[model samples]
Target: MSSTPGLSTTKQFRNLLLSDQLEFICEAHNGLSAKIVQEAGFKGIWASGLSISAQFGVRDNNEASWTQVLETLEFMSDATTIPILLDGDTGYGNFNNMQRLVRKLEQRKIAAVCIEDKLFPKTNSFIKGDAQPMADMHEFCGKIKAGKDAQSDPNFSIIARVESFICGWGLAEALRRAEAYRQAGADGILIHSALAVPDEILAFKQEWGNRCPVVIVPTKYYATPTDVFRQHNFSIVIWANHLLRSSVTAMQKTARTLKEQEHLLSIEDKVAPVSEIFRLQNAAELQEAEDRYLPRGAEDTCAIVLAASRGSELGELTEHQPKTMVKIQGTPILTHIADAYNAVGIKDIVVVRGYKKETVNLPNLTYVDNDEYAETGELASLLKALQSRKGRAQHTIVSYGDVLFNKYIPQSLCQESDDCVIFIDSNWREQSRYSRLGGFAECSIPNSRRAFNAKVYLKQLGNKIPESNTHGVWMGFLKVSPAAATLITTIITELLAQPGNRKATIPQLLQELLKRQQPIRVLYTVGHWLDINNLEDVVQAGEF
Candidate 1:
């Protein structure tokens, strides 16, 4: 458990759209902030070398005293329950320092950490006119391998952050470094970029989406929409320092008001009341504590799958029926989605009907009519179903209607203990052999705070669901809970506030999560998958 003040700080930032997963890793900021964030329900904590160096009003250098970093890690980890990941700038020294830093961070019980490929006193990459060459790929990989071997827990992730993109090393250098990092047993890679176009980001994801999960910060360049990244399969998009950004803006506003008005109460309208400040996070999630009806048992978990419309995207084959209905060896894709959950013994089916609802009906099924389905994505249909359920289940499963994958929904659903879990394909390896459509859908969860569409959700798995249960999105399958249903409903309704043109896609909805920092459970699916997106897909379906 976290301290009350720390939890409250977590809630406060989350209320302001700062994500708990974004893990505020500051180089110079107070380590106490770590305790604050952990209490706020953040999944992890971060220590940034850049910010830490700036704190002394001195530039960061490769020779940054390791004692300071060690002390920071110790204090932060000792104060929080969540994992603490530190930014070990250039590994504090060399291969030996890298080894020492690994031991030091673990001694503090830090969640995970990273060491960048940069030289001494590395000038800020984001600063114009500032440039530095990255370390040799072989050497960086060796350091990463050393760190990996030092890790005691297999799940304790070690990220290899490549600054080649930001350092103007170009894509070739970045990719080369990324490959080296992955080979070095780096569990993940964060492609540091102070400047990146949408296509470049997509290219990066296309190139290395499957090699290992890639992470990024949208605020790095302040360019590219959330949808573009979603299409590319860039797994982790940690929203960088919005709290500091907002704090700066708010402070300036207050200063201007007081200076101009000649009074501390210069402007009242500019000041947001507490009610308005924490509405999205504390106001809403806290409401769940009161209105949220605690379930009596595990029976509250429900499995849901929304079928995609039959479109010419599949060509003349789907001209009569929907794509989900298009037979796969005489069995519909919707059936596969159902069977995924059926394998787990959960037969309560909730289908969101849109373009040809009557064509996919089954016995004992609950149909959630999405009259706007043709105009919206699977997310809209999910919203309608959540409203229909009125937060009925303690947990729920959600999946796209057109997916063609093998899964064991019940077992998967029972594995996680979060409010939302996304069934990702562990084998969803991308290749140029495919078309230029959406690549593998990467799990770029904003954090465990931002509100997201019902296409993903959480459900407590503490209760027994049996060893035979399989949670998969094969062809189609997903699960969630009553608590998550309510949150998603709120997210959908909030999306309605956005401009009409942008509210139609789930990825667009995901952007909203970036601003909201809602929590989600992203579970990788260890099953086969095929998307029925276009005519070629129909050809691909036959092979499946």
Candidate 2:
């Protein structure tokens, strides 16, 4: 018989019991921990209520609420494809609550839930000792029946957790309650005990025989061998609360060590690295989502604008705002550049601001502050922004804060085939003097009168290009594909490690890529472009 995808986990879980081999279920508190359990070769997950509540620093007395547990289970369900058996404490209330909980769990693709026959707002068994009261057998059985009736998937389990052992009511009462729950439509029975040995569990399992599958959480009796569990005919074994406990211990040790030494060097090797955390968070999937759902004009592309410089040339404008914050016509120059990208649906914009950062505000844009702006150069600001986006963006555009150009230039750069595209104006030498006043664009091209101020394409600075080989002047804009961006970022990282190169310019970094024989594509455009250096250029920008 062919099976549908819906409730496939529930079906798999039911089959696990029928196979006669014990299923090992590990407890997980969050999605990341759930992935760890699956990667460790566990067959299924047991979403322990104690672990879930402790994750939020709350007590395990239903203080975290059923909704909170359901939310955590949803994350576990999304993080792994294995079956998740949730711990439903006292059915979260009564028969009506049990019905809702069953429906929600089934909807979330949970395989099963073990609801104990105890009073509502149940405390952890190991904590309250023998004082915990057990619920009436007939009424608790009705809760199981309601849960079973509400589940649309026949394989979705409602396992009855008997509290008789915890209440010191002995094996006879436990067997009787388990049988009653089985008659009321519980698919399995979870006989719990807080004893340090497995004798009570073994006796219950032996007397119960194969009447139904027996599930046990060997927390207190963790030293018992798997062979012992198998010999007792236990169908499933849960290692509950261990993962969260270990995490707490490791974290506390790290925190205490840091407090004593006041540094991270002592505990660096003992903890997991940030890269591993990134992998656990599935950052690559987030980038893919950005590529899929974000506006496709640039297709997973982003841009970083180096706007930290104060633009000392623009005298009065320097008094209040950063260079990019200077107004061109009625709007800020930064706003103009952002609008150009946003016009073509390029929404992932990161602007590095330093001088008067609070004054350069724009909606729907990310900002990173260059705290060392006064002592460092533009590359330092770029590094700050790029650091925030490492391994998160592939195709990116790097632009200067002072340049204003036709929006079509960026659109054209996006469709190129090469790893990097340098926007240049080949006609800069022939243009009138007013245009040159903006600043002479520079490249490695030697003896080129048009190459003067080295503002853009810093990655191409040190190479000496014959005037004849030079096609145009750098236009303060670049489109870097994934491969070239990675290389450029790597070179920048290496340079920043050197004491003298920490404040290296963008053009200097581009020159490193050029020296390494990285192919640099040039996009020659004669469209109206303005590089605002002084007040005259800002006026020219406003006029043009």
**Per-prediction TM-score to the true structure, in the order listed:** 0.42, 0.64
Q: Write the per-residue lDDT of candidate 2 for residues 1-544, one digit (tens) a residue.
A: 1222454889878876665787788899999999999888787888999999999999999999899899999998998888888988899999999999999998899999999998988989988658888999999999998998898998998889998999989999999999999999889999999988999999998888999898999888888889998877789988988999999999899989999999889989888999999988889999988767655457567888889878888888878988898888889999999998887667899999888888878999999999788888767887787778878856788888888877787787776657877776767555434232122344444334454433223224323544455445666776887777777777878888888976678767666767788767665567557788777788789876
- Sequence-dependent TM-score of model 1: 0.42
Quantify all predictions' global Cα lDDT against the true fold: 0.60, 0.81
- Candidate 1's residue-wise lDDT over 307-357, tens digit each? 645566777777667777887778877787778766666677788877777
The residue-level lDDT of candidate 1 at 530 comes to 66
Distance (Å) between predicted and true CA of 185, model 1?
A: 1.6
Error of 1 at 147 (Å): 1.7
Flag clash pairs in model 2.
458-506, 458-507, 458-508, 458-510, 459-509, 459-510, 459-511, 460-510, 460-511
